[model samples]
Target: MKVVIAPDSFKGSITATDAATAIAEGWASVDPAAEIVRRPMADGGEGTVDAFAAAVADAKRMPITVDGPAGASVRTSWLLLPPTEDAPAGTAVIDLASTSGIELMDRLRPWEADTTGFGQAIAAALEHGVSRLVLGIGSSASTDGGTGLLRALGARFLDDGGAPVAAGARGVLAIASVDMSGLRPPPETFVLTDVTNPLTGPRGTAAVFGPQKGLTEPSDIESVDDALLRLADLLGLDAQHPGTGAAGGVGGALVAWGARLTPGAQEVAELLDLAATIEGADVVVTGEGSYDGQSGDGKVPSFVAGLAASAGARAALVAGRITADADIGLFAGVASLTEIAGSAEAALAEPARHLRQAGAALARSLSD
Candidate 1:
């Protein structure tokens, strides 16, 4: 029997690479002779670079330091995929969640967090002369509408007095003019995300995602929304385009820079050549930190399940937590680390252990 293990990072606990390895180990324990292929995956978020590093033999990490969401220096690296037929110079994969993401902040800098680091990393990759860019724009820390990133790329957000404004949402609100003469031109950029929100309305960046970044009062959300609208106007771009509201308006900002917004899971799958591996597998195992209603909506697990179905493979799932809203019927086998560990706390305490058990459980289902 052949089995392919591909899972996303169990956020705050285990990485996708480790999770895939652990699951493979457990599956091997049950079926010692089964062929196992571990292909760790990410949907343009926290583990995106790791995913590429694990999938491609020639992929390299180019390290660089940049400003974090809270204005601190952050050491991070972008993945550089070796030159391909389609991309002669190579491709750079940069994920926002690891650089200027919310996790980098000690506390929510709702009004002050920015994407400067993300932009800096991208700038470094550009300097390296990468021909194409795959940007994961999830888990942003601020709603600055990508101003911090733009600033790092040489686009100036000036005040009425012609001086640069402060960074973050605060700076976005005070913007009185724009300068793009010094901005760098991005080449064939693709922004990966599942979001389809507009930039500045009820379903826009501030209105929907601001509270998560600490915006509470209606007035606060309204103010940020207005600021984003103003920024869009200045950029002469449509604010209501789908996905413009992603990553606290980073999506919209990238759109202003000529980025093509694409679904994260699908894009990553193609880059990893995931479907080809599942083509003849007997069982395909996939996972994520949480399997809930949202998981079915273009998440790694759901997308993997679809591929498994197409290949006539039995899809199995092992999740950190499988919520009641998730449809377990989508998979031939399902295991929850929370249930196996007897508690959510215990599951997170030793995720690798539970992931192993989850793998064993799915392996048992194969014979039954």
Candidate 2:
């Protein structure tokens, strides 16, 4: 029998790699002869770089320092994959959360935060001569329509005086024109995200994501949303394009700079060659920190289940917390920390141990 253990990071607890290890150990305890495969997964968020580092042989980490979301400095690293036939010079992988994510902020600077740090990292990667770029643009801290990122790449966001505007959403409101004459793009670029929102409108960036970044007031949301519309107009971006509203409109901005937007989970699945690994598996197990209704929308668990079903293998999902309406029908079996640990607090406090327990339980039930 063969079992593949692939899971995403349990946020605020264990990483994807550790989760996979713990599960595999438990599975081994039950079926020592079963072939086990461990694959850690991420959907273009915080753990993106680590995912590639673990899966790709000869991958290196390139360290750099850049501005943080709230005007501070942050030390982070991007991943460099060794040369391939498609990208002979190599490929650079960057996660926006490492440099410009809301997690880096002490307090939300909703309007003042920007994507400058993300842009700086990208610039550094370009300077290193990478032939292609893979950018994970999730967990952003601002809704500046990506003006700050464009600025770092030499695209000017000018005020009425033809001078550079301030960075962040405030800059978005002050922009008189946009200049892309000095912008530099790599041979190929992929912007990884799961969002499909428009650039600006009732369902756009500010309206949907601003509150999470501290822009809760109706006035604030309206102001930023309008500014994003202005930014789009000046950039000649289609506000209604799918994914244009991702990362506070960074998706649209990257599109303007010649980058393609891809569904993060599907993109990562291809990179990991998940389907090929599931072809002969008896059962495929996957997991995440939380399993909710939204998990069905391009999240790791749903993607894994789809691949397992295609390969004629039963799929089991294990998560830290599995909500009541999480579309449990997608998996043949489901295990959650809340049920195994008796409480959410206990589960979070000792996630690895509980994850192991869940794995053993799944193995026993599936083997029956």
Candidate 3:
């Protein structure tokens, strides 16, 4: 049988590459004649660069250091894909998680963290003469409404005195004007994200996502939300635009810079050519750290299921933990690390081993 193993990272346990490797190994154990095709997935988040680097041919990593989520410096890199027919000069892939994610914060700086580092990385890629840019804006650490990023890209967020304001959300209220004459943007830019929030108001960035970024107080949320609204007005952007609120309003800022926002899952799938890879497969296997109610919403498993269905293949899953409310009917076979290892701690301690065991079990059951 031909099988495709495509999974997202188990988040703190195993990466998508390692997970696919383990599952493939286990599947091979059950069916020694099986042909396994591995295609790990990422939804415009932390693993985006690695996913592309692994799937795309001749992808190089360009390293650079920039400001981190707080005030510290971080060593990060962006992907440089070999020149394609569509993009003669090649494409630059940048992810906000590496430069300005919450993982970089020791103590959350709700009001002071910024995306300057992310912007700086983009600037570096631009300087390298990339013809196209793909930006993954997820796991952000601030609610700055992309001011810090725009600043790094040559836009000036100046106060009434014509001086730049602070680095993070603190500068939101101090913004008096925006000058974009010096900004040099790419000819083609795509903002990849799964978020669908608008730029301001109740379901917007500051109100819905700010608390997770350290805006715990109601006053802080209100202040940041209002500040974002003011920013939208200054930039002449639609505050109600879908996905404008992703990554703490970086989505809207990117749109202001001529980016087109698209669903990250679909975009990544297309980039990886997942549909073509599964065309002749008998089964497509996918998983994540947890399978819950939210797993159906543009996540790896659901995305793989759809692809497998389109290709006339059955889809299976091997998740770390499956919540009681999870809808398992979407997959032809389902396995969980918890069920294999007998406990969550055991599963977490030896994720690869348990994941392999789960894969073997699924293969055996399918062969029955």
Candidate 4:
């Protein structure tokens, strides 16, 4: 049987490529004669760079210094794909999550974190003369409504007192006017995002995601909401644009800067040529750290499964934890589903073993 393995990162347990490899290995052990193709996938979130780099040739890593989530100096990395003779000379892929990801901050200091480093990274990429920038916006820690990132790129946020506020969620509320004099124009920019939340309101940035960023109680919620409103008014932005709440309002800011916002999985899948990869496979396996209702909303695993079904291939999921009520049927040709372990701790403690087990179960089901 021709089998394709394409899985997202197992969160803290494994990389997407490694997850694919483990699944492939398990399938190989079960059916030694199986023809297996491995394609790692990401949702343009945390592992976007690694997934794209592994799939496409000529993508290289470039290291640069940027601010950490806590306003400290941190050395982070971004991907640099040197242009071919036929392509433009200055095109780069950037994952904003790499610099401002929630995972990058200390849990105790989430309130103090910001996205300044992400903006700095963008500036650095621009300095390299990159004409086209593809930025993945996910896993953010800041709820400053993207003001922090804008500030880093030379946009200044001044209070009514004409004093500069700090760069965090708390700082967003004090904005009286924005000074864009220091901003440099980029040729073109695209922001790949996985969410559709608006900038402000019940379904807005702070309400939907602030709690996850270490925000506690109704007061913290009110604080972030107020801050976002202030920033929106100061920047003359519509507070209700779809996807404006993405990455804590970074989506709206990018839109203000004329960046195109597309589904994260769709953009990454097209970039990786995922549809073409699935065409020849008899069965395809795709998954993530967790699979739930959110997976149906333009996530990587669902994207891969959709492609597999379109190509007349059976798809399966191998996730670390599968929520009981998740609609697995959305993955139309997904013939099998397997959770890595019964719990998170077990999965993390022995990811390789659990992956092999999941793979074996899938192999048996497919062969049956």
Candidate 5:
């Protein structure tokens, strides 16, 4: 049987490549002659660069030092796509999450962090003469509405007193003016975002994602809202752009910088030629850290399943855990869903064993 294993990282447990390898190992055990193709996938989030590196032959690493979310210096890696006919110079794949990701901040003081480091990364990539920057905006901690990122990129935010205020959400409400004269020109930039929330309103950055960033009560919501409004007015942005609210309004900042926003998974899939691989496969398996309604919204797993269905191949999903009432039908090509046993903590404690078990079970089911 020709089987394809393509899975996203199981968050803190395993990487997408590791997940695919585990599944491939299981399929090999079931039938030594099985042709198992492993393709790691990401939704242009944390593991994006790594996934692309694994798939493309000309991808190389460039490590650069940038400011961390907490203003500390941190060294992060970005991917450089070798020069091609379309991109003779080269293209840079930058995962914004690497610098400003929530995982990089102290959860106890998430409100104090910023995305300045993310801008620093972009600046570094630009320094290399890379015209196209594929930025992945996901897993951010700050809700300052991307003011911090803009500040690092030469966009100045002045308080009502006509002075620079302290960085972070705490100072967002005090901004009275914005200056964007310092931004350097790049040929083109594309921001790959996973969410579609506006910059303000109930589904906005603060209202929908602030709580996750450590804002426990509704009392603090107004401050974030006010700050976002101030930013919107100063930048002449609609504040209701479809994905303006993503990654703490990083999308807003990118939009202001003339970036084209596209679905994260779709962009990555095209870059990796995922559909071509699924076309002749007899079966396809895809997964993530968790499976539920959210997965249907252009996530990696759902994108793979949809492609498999269009190619007349059956798809299956495996996740660390599955939501009880999730809309499984949303995955039109997915024939079955499997969940690894134990809680997230347990799975993380023994990732390899759990992955093997999950893979074995999946292999048996597919064979049956």
Candidate 6:
């Protein structure tokens, strides 16, 4: 029997790499002779680089220290996929969650957070002469309309007196003009995200995502939204463009730099060559932290199930918590660590322990 295991990170509990390893262990324990394969997955968030590294044998981790969201030094590495015939120089995969994500902040610095680290990482990747850039814009810590990122890329955000403003949303609210003369040109950039919000207004980043980034006052959100509109006007780009508001306006910033927005799951699947990996498997297993109503809308499990359908294989799921709204019927077999552990707290406290149990149950379900 051949089994392919692919799972996204269990969020705060375990990483995709560790999850796959645990699942593979459980499967191997059940049928020691089974041919088990692993291909961890990510949707352009925290584990994107890890996914690429696991899938691509020639992928390299380029370590660099950059200024974090709160202007502190952050240690992180971006992935560099070795040169192929199509890309003579190679490709760089960077994820915002690692460099400029909320997890790095000890306290909410809504007005003080920025994306400088993300852009600095990108600048380093560009310096490596990569032919293409794949950026994952998720888990943002600021709502500065990408001003911090652009600043690192040589774009000057200035006030009416031609003086540079402070970093973070404070600077975004004071922006009067922008100078991109010294900005570096990026090669074929592709932004991976699922958000479709525009750059301003009620449905925009500042209005919709600002609260999560620590925006407390309604007036503060409004101020950031107004500044983003001004930035949009200065850049001569559409403020209402879909995905422009993703990652607290990092999506819009990349757009201004000539990048294309694509669905995170689909783009990541292609980058990891998921369809090719699951092609003739007898049992294909995939999972995530939670499976809810939104799971069908381009999550790892649904995409893996679709691929299994095309490959004529049975797909199973092992989620941390499966909600009532999730369409569990998509998978031939399903296991929830929460249910197996008898409580969500227990499941979370020891996710790997329950994950292995879930794996074994799913393996037995094949006979039932």
Q: Model 4 residue 219 lDDT?
A: 82
> What are the C-alpha RMSDs, in order, of all predicted structures?
1.0, 1.4, 1.5, 2.3, 2.1, 1.4
Q: In candidate 1, residue 193 scores what lDDT?
A: 93
Model 3 root-mean-square deviation:
1.5
The total of clashing pairs for model 2 equals 0
Report the lDDT of model 1 for residue 284: 94
Give candidate 1 regions above 4 Å deviation.
none
Supply the global lDDT for candidate 1: 0.92
- TM-score-sorted candidate list, best first: 1, 6, 2, 3, 5, 4
**Local distance difference test, per candidate?**
0.92, 0.89, 0.90, 0.80, 0.80, 0.89
Which residue pairs collide in model 3, if any? none
Q: Which regions of candidate 4 fall more than 4 Å away from where they truly are?
A: 84-87, 330-342
TM-score of each: 0.98, 0.96, 0.96, 0.93, 0.94, 0.96
Pairs in clash, predicted candidate 4: none
Residue 98 of model 2 has an lDDT of 90
lDDT per residue for candidate 3 within 117-150, as digits (tens), equals 9999999999999999988898899999998889
Ten residues in a row with the worst lDDT in model 4?
A: 331-340
Error of 4 at 36 (Å): 2.4
lDDT of 4 by residue, 250-312 (tens): 998888777888988888888778888888888888988878877887888888888888999
Q: How do the residues 1-368 of candidate 1 rate in per-residue lDDT, one tens digit apiece?
A: 99999999998898899999999988888988899999999888888889889999889999899899999999889999999888899999999988999889899989889999999999999999999999998788899999999989999999999999999999988999999999999999988998989998999989999999998899999999998998999998899999999999999889999899999999999999999988889999999999999899999999999999999999999998999888988798999999999999999999999899888888877944
Candidate 6: global Cα-lDDT?
0.89
Q: Which tens-of-lDDT digit does each residue in 1-368 have in candidate 6? A: 88899898898788888899888888877777888899998887778888888989989999999999998899999999988876789999999988999889998899999999999999999999999999988889999888888889999999999999899999888889889999999898889987889999999999999999899799888889998999899988799999999999989999998999998888988877888888878889999999999899888889888888899999999999999999988799999999999998999999988888877887777633
Pick by TM-score: which candidate is best?
Answer: 1
On lDDT, the candidate that comes out on top is: 1
Stretches > 4 Å off in candidate 2: none
